[model samples]
Target: MRGGNTNGPDGNLRKDVETALLRPNLTPWQRTFLTDIHARLERSGGQARLSDKQWRKIFEILGRPNNVIALPPRTVTAYPPRRQPSKLFRPRFGWVGRRLRWRLRNLAIGFLIVAAVALGQQVFNLGRGQFQSTPTSTRALQTQEFSVTDGDTVHVVGEATGTRLVGFNTPEKFSPQCEYERQLGERASSRLRELVAHGSIQLTKVACACAPNTEGTSECNFGRSCGVLQVDGKDVGSILISEGLAVSFVCGRTSCPPAPRPWCKG
Candidate 1:
């Protein structure tokens, strides 16, 4: 009788109904009480199901208040544990060290090669008599035409050629009064012609002071032999000197005379 309502819609009338059953205005405490009751009923296998929106509202109510609990201090932990003193300071022999050593070796080799080449050049120049200083003038002979007069003397076409020949005195051409001298001269001349006839000869011009003869022929005061005359890398003067056909007559300020031998005197 306490639970029945006589005016319930579509129901047969019950004799007893409470006035509190029709009340709609519940207080906050009463609402809380009803919520707890409803939750208990749901746990006891009631027909009510919590949708997504209702669950979110319930979660928000249970979460911590904004100013109540402070978050733990944030910490940055490094990955891959840091090296200790011994490990951190250990020496590493890497490719960089090897590369530096190799570079140094190459530099030393390059320096050695340069030094060797320089030394070789010095030795070569010394051996070839290039270090010997001879005073040679740049004056051209007035006469360009010259003929093989004897072994050493060359006849010129004009007075200028004879003047130019003053510094280089050769043997007389076919002299009867000095027949022995003439024969020696002819022999020397023939030998020279044979040696350089078809070969290229480089004439080096020189200047000197020597009196010309009445026939306008000049003689070499420094003697006619010495110095270098190269042919295919062979020293012509040295060859003749070695053969005793010519003497090593140092010319210019250096006063070395020709050897007083029979072959060289003529």
Candidate 2:
């Protein structure tokens, strides 16, 4: 006689057999029987019917105490419903989501690297005097407060240290290499004094090209601080250069070029 539906709209029998296939210690006969039932259910699309003997065998393998006749009105606990995988743990969007996240992380890392390099370059420039922002210190000088040492050097009234004006070089006056240099140095010094006589003298200190402990040596402008002198809002170096009293002298990243030899003028 035909028994109850094995694979039907209820699906309990088919699901129970499928659940039994997952048990680890099932005998080979039990596994083979459950697997055959699953295959038949798949082929018949849950419409497969079993005979009474087959129904008894299925319940026996599934560890259920009921036969097909006792299955209609009772709940089947032999196999519980399969738990659905949670959306949070499942890869819903597959590889696309993972790739996008990876790209965003790389972009953030790239931005940080670029910022670090730019900061390093700025520090390097500041140390070398190749790039500067505001002056480190500013001094206002009165006519009598400073004495012109030469065309480009000056000694302030109260300070023991002298200041060498940057951006221009004048002839040597302290120990001229030639008579022509001595004469030119005198003319330049006189002109510098004239320039400082009338207008506001402002000295803006800047970084000097010298090692940490070598301020008094020739490397650090011979013990003098480096400054930019502005008189009446005009750069003293620019004035001297325009009047042919001094030649333009600028330092690179490391140090200033050798002083121009105007002593033997061509």
Candidate 3:
């Protein structure tokens, strides 16, 4: 029969009343008790409020009637069961797709390495020729004696009968300027014979139209035989051009064009 006191020490009773009212499920007798407590607290002029500790205890007592309110032993949800990560998501693979990708990468690297090595070898071979020493004089051709026929022609005795000196065409013996051309040719031939008579001469056999065969035939025999007369290291054609006695002759070959000089024209 204790009436509620607004200014009195009823902190525990107010807590109990709040806890009982917050319960999700209550019996008929519990509901009536909480309503009566609430009414009594209202009449106390708003000074009675519940403490937290006493409210928790009263909440446990009032919630005992509901089995659902007992919180079902904190059961883990099985609706969205934790899926084990798929094997496809793993990076390690022994299949063809991964192996093919690895092989392609290795092939690309190997090709790049081979290309670099080939380029380096080519450059090394190109520069190797520059460091080689010049050839000795003993390796050069032995000189042969010759008689000067004219300004641009010479007669050299050979083991075989008729090997003509190439690269100059003198005027005909009875032509209008024959005397002048003959004098020039004789002088040129004498100078060439003197330069090559005792010294070694490097002869390079080239295909030429004016070269003669063994029977003195101007046409090609079974072979493409020709003559290039070189004295000391100078080409006889270039020497004749420098002396103004003979002009340059260019045969119409795949490599050489027609001679471009006024003197060479018909």
Candidate 4:
């Protein structure tokens, strides 16, 4: 035989085994199995000596032959003899533990992939104008304007707006995708600043989205609104998009900005 039942780590199984063997009602086979198990446990320090199969032999020996559970023969090793990796194949708690860990690892990987797909789908729907709950419109709002933070982002002097120019998005100054993205972002910011610097810039809130600024650590509007920036009655978005400095987009209604993306890449 490749191996017999290993001794139990705990001494309890052997105690039960010893008590059963001493019973006067035991059949000859039962007495014999118990005696052998007791002896092996003693030799091994404190545990049952029977291999899992040998331990199971007690069930058959004690049970009426006809009433015995239909378990595999105890004579067979948990792992068949002569197999190359008989050790891992053994039906022991150790092997079961390893199998469980492997299963959990695969399950975690599956969850990550599922989450990624779901996030991607949401972005796709946003770009396709599927958000119906929030409506978009373009209206020239006359308000006290403060400064142009970037090409598309603007901040009102006294917290009056969370507005960004609709219809188009510029490269991100905070988080750029690549060198090209960074360069484009700087150029866009400069252009918008120049446009506002000269005379006056008015926002035509057209096709606006209710996108929240998520970058606020506590209380700050870091996000921009989607709208047409009206300069002398001309659309700033149209000009920038035409010049390739910005891209045509609807903030929450259309697609999100793309390029060197990690947060936006979803």
Candidate 5:
């Protein structure tokens, strides 16, 4: 009834639709409503043709269905975080190399400290005249074997060794500090020569107090040997000290005090 126009007296169109609905290919709705629609058309004497709404429904049923493909929803998988490398996987010698370098550096520093101590000890021993060894055997000497150098020093005739008396020191004759000292030194030297010339001279060699590795060097009393001089079992040093010619010159293990010179005193 709501269509734009009504059909005319077209009995042929109604007969044609009836003929199509009777066919075997017709839908269930088309077949069931076919008799109803024909009876109505007969009642109206085919004055009303099929409406546009009924025709549109029949055409829609005859068309193809939608072609939508149904797929499952997208899935997202979660994985664990990336693992970091362990110490085992690192370079094998990296720690070893660092430790070895540290040890070597320490060893080098230790060596330098040891060397510095040794050098300092050597420097401290200088001019100290440290006592080394004492000889117990007495050596008897003839007049030709040695010659008196001064009041307390003697030179071996053929040997290059020089001897310094251990117990006493006289004023310097070769390098005197004053004229009176020179005169006293000459008298002391004359007295020593007279004592050694007449009596049985006994010389006992003693190791000079010197620094390590400096026994032959100039630091060791110019390479002079130390000795105790005795004539006829009497110590020459005692006789000289008692006669007011030389001063008592005692030495400790490492050093000796400057000899007290009476001749040079004002």
Candidate 6:
């Protein structure tokens, strides 16, 4: 047998109440009263759920009480009761969930990138000095050759070495003595770029304690190293020197070529 409330005075009263609520052009206060009464009746009657029509009427009244336009109402008479929606929220739950998921994915990717960079830096700093003391050092370096710094230097990293071309000097591109020197420096830098454009270069690390904007300095004003640059089994320094693009420089034994300057006395 179907278990239900017997149609007594209480059931008739409940039916009357629902009918009144479901009628058109209800006043704001009357609609609110009907909804409250409906909720109380269901609570007292062992939570016997209302029909979709009844639930839809209550929701419409509460959500858009001013709208006179009739719309299809949702069923409320669900057994065990459907989850009540938030009173103030619009119906965008699915879109909200999807957007939140998308942003969470981007956040995860960002965290992964940060973690990788940190790991790489730690690996780089482990006992492999960026600027080695001499070019002839037996220990090899871990670096990827990038671009030439000037006529006699190139930039590298994996351990971040600022390597200078050993055995020669080029015109001062970084800090030129005169217009002529700057012009020559640019030409020298161009040639150097061409020479190193071939392959995964044989990397070396040598420490040079050079000053900023100076080609070769023992004083070490900037973080740089003196290292031999080779491209395709050819020494870049020797090429520049022979081609007259650069002048010879020997460390701790012979001096660099005479500076071309207004400061140099004739």
Residue 37 lDDT (model 3): 53
Instruction: Evaluate all candidate structures by whole-model CA lDDT and list the values in order.
Output: 0.40, 0.72, 0.48, 0.55, 0.67, 0.56
The regions of model 4 sitting more than 4 angstroms off are 1-144, 206-208, 211-226, 251-266
lDDT of 6 by residue, 1-266 (tens): 00133122324536656777877887655566576757767776833433212333444444433212222244597589677878887555598888998999999999999999999888776534533543344333223335565787665542233466677778864345455666777798898877666533455555443434553432441334567766666677788778878877666432344443442223
Q: For candidate 3, what is the lDDT?
A: 0.48
Kindly list the per-residue Cα lDDT of model 2 for residues 13-128, writing each as its tens digit. 67888888999997665676678878987898765755333455677677775322423343556877899999888866668988998899999999999999999999988766
Pairing residues by index, what is the TM-score of model 3? Answer: 0.33
Across residues 1-266, which tens digit of lDDT does each residue of candidate 5 receive? 21212232332535655666757876454565555556766777765434322333333333423222123244788998999899787766688888998999999999999999999988767524333332364456887787777789887654444678887889865556577887788899899999988999888877766666776555666556788899998989999989988888888765667667777777
- Give TM per candidate: 0.30, 0.46, 0.33, 0.36, 0.47, 0.38
In candidate 4, what are the lDDT values of residues 213-248, reduced to their tens digit? 433211222233335567767777787778778876
- Would you give me the overall lDDT of model 1? 0.40
TM-score of 4: 0.36
lDDT of 3 by residue, 157-195 (tens): 332222334555443221213345435545665666666
Best by TM-score: 5
Note each model's CA RMSD in angstroms: 56.8, 43.8, 54.5, 35.0, 63.4, 35.0
Q: For model 6, what is the C-alpha lDDT against the true structure?
A: 0.56
Local lDDT at 44 for model 1:
43
lDDT of 1 by residue, 47-134 (tens): 2322212222322333312111112245797799876779777677699978988999999999999999999999988756643543
Q: Who is ahead in TM-score, 3 or 5?
A: 5
Query: In model 6, which runs have C-alpha deviations exceeding 4 angstroms?
Result: 1-144, 158-161, 207-221, 253-266
